[model samples]
Target: MKRSHIPPLLDRKWLAPLLITSSLSLLLFLSFSLINAKFPPPASGFSGGGSSSELPRLPRLAYLITGTKDDGARVKRLLQAVYHPRNYYLIHLDLEAPEGERLELARYVKSEGVVREFGNVMVIGDADLVTAQGPTMIASTLHAIAVLLKRAKDWDWFINLSASDYPLVPQDDLLHIFSYLPRDLNFLEHSGDLGYKEVERARPIIIDPGLYHLKKSGVFYAKERRSLPASFKLFMGSAWVVLTKPFLEFCVWGWDNLPRTLLMYYTNFLSSPEGYFHTVVCNHKDYQNTTINHDLRYSRWDNPPKQHPITLTMEHLDDMVRSGAPFARKFEKDDPVLNRIDKELLMRLDGRFTPGAWCMGSSRAGKDPCLVSGSPIVVKPTLSSRRLEKLIANLLDPETFRGKQCK
Candidate 1:
């Protein structure tokens, strides 16, 4: 080949291509950073372990803070109350929320100095279909657990919370006590639908569109009803639960295949959330003994019973604290009782981070003092921790603890 014709391109073209490739690589890197900055992980919760001689070493929690249509602010409040550096968080907004709300929630997560620093929180880019009373609720929870497991191997517990729910005790109080608990224990309420089958819920069949559809819609019913499962006993309880990582993994992996089958069978079952965790825990041999028979929430149902549980108000403050439950649910948005709880129970004010032993800043009068974020450890259990300590003690007494297993 002649020098002039020998692809003059090979002579200097190599440098141009190299420069172009380098520039593209740099641009790609910067674009990724900006995308991450804008959409940051949908994280809205935190976790850490506290001491519980009655329970094992305190375990790290992986929280899934999920919300639907217009829940951005509620999720933000939930995340702040529960945030901790020692655990993992995955925030999820259902497909119903507008793009603006999703982006707004993401912006809030990224703007937090602590959230950006820890980098343990994440947002679900593709939100799941979550119906109010469908098996999809269970599916969504399992999906979160699967994602958390895939992302980090350190969390010991998996807690699910809604935008409507709030924590009564600080994470530090909960962590301090949970540290002394067995890692395999599961907390859920159980009534077993025993004599209650005649009631509408146990006998009826319903379908949730959230598992399949995009727009928000109520669960549907089928005329051709089916009988209950003969293979497994049916148990029912509160939708909210505090599940151990082991149990959640079992539900997701289901080496025995029960989890998947129940998921399918419950597709038509009414209020599946009330039964999914209950049935799974009751039937699993390895995990049945770990069931704690309590939902760890202070939910008050009406005297004769109503579709929705009674809402907590300022009047319920004393009952809430005496209940010994660490969390409560179904409060109105920005209720005055929330302020009372923050002032009296959490010592949180001014919409700042809740101060804990990990927060080294000293407070005066009513100022929020979490500005100085110190070592993430060093839990300071308060009188609230003592209340929880006593409550957990009674629950774990050998007579009650062993006797209540899977009953």
Candidate 2:
């Protein structure tokens, strides 16, 4: 059959347009496919057939619980008190702690059935030397943050605690209450007014030997003082902090030079942990407004406050509960008050996890219900959640929330 032949110019023009159209179509299809692959259609429900909009996803907390010599037992107890199937825990015992203690803690964490199953808990094998009121403490915290960012991909917040600290509320209660919060808010006690710290902390140049030497040693003053930094103002507050993951990523990766600049400036500052994060968070424009001016910890300091808070005891239990703080500090190892807290506040027994909705097993014969685990997303908050909610409401009040930020 003789087919009609078009002119060469007409054929070229038609073939070019056809090729161009095919390429454009392919490029668009590939782009749309990639977009869909990255972000799939929202699910109708998480489990049963229901609207997913009704269910709020709980936020995950990444905790860096640190301790020093003879703190292994306290660390273990604190881990048990705060342990949850959904949250991630990184336990670090400082260089002052014996190798045996670190190994013991690692063994204990590996041995736990629930912890082993969830694989959310980690122990730092190579520990840092954290000097009291020194830059090494800040360094250790930054190290932990870096490790957490590298290891976990979904945590919403970073909470730094110590072995001396104990939780007053269960993880489920905390997760339930925090799920309602704006993810960008950062809870930290910060103040730009550095009265005594200007003299005792800011001006003084102390060298933390822990940054160099492997052995633990006291930080020594340089004798010469440096003037206050004009580039950025100094802020100081409690060492305990609960910070958003985005803010921490900024601090760790430091797309801008502000974080690294402040970090270097704070290297010689006394009690850098108290001021480093405060200063960093308050000075940066992007994060300054996110500050919530609270540490979320309860501690009773002596009149004119000492280097550390007074050891919490039975006498302070009522006050602690009234404070509505999630955690409290400076508790003596194996204190009787802790036992009372376990029995009453946490509803936990000896050598058992604090029970929550995720716990599925029966409590028959005083069995640990958490021994059998269920879906961690299921949260059943208690009366304690109400208390925490009230506290958060007060903190987020329009009059107080913005007024106290970065001030």
Query: TM-scores of all models?
Result: 0.83, 0.87
lDDT score, candidate 2: 0.79
Model 2, residue 277: distance off in Å is: 0.9
On residues 1-407, what C-alpha lDDT tens digit does candidate 1 reach at each position? 00111110111111100101111111111011111111112122222333434223446788888998889888888888887666677888877877677778777666776666666677776677777777677777777777776666777788888888888898878887776666666888886644554356666788787766777688888786666668988888788888876666667655557777777777777777888888888896666777778888887888766666898898888988998889898798899998888878887774576667766566877544566666565566677877777677777766777677666
Clashing pairs in 2: none
| Alpha-carbon shift of residue 84 in model 2 (angstroms) | 0.4
Which lDDT tens digits does candidate 2 get at residues 91-164?
A: 88888999899889888887887787787888888777889988889888888888777677789999999999
- Given candidate 2, what's the lDDT at residue 167? 94
Q: Report the error of model 1 at residue 198, Å.
A: 5.3
Worst 10 residues of 2 by lDDT: 10-19
- Candidate 1's C-alpha runs over 4 A off are 1-56, 362-368
lDDT of each: 0.70, 0.79
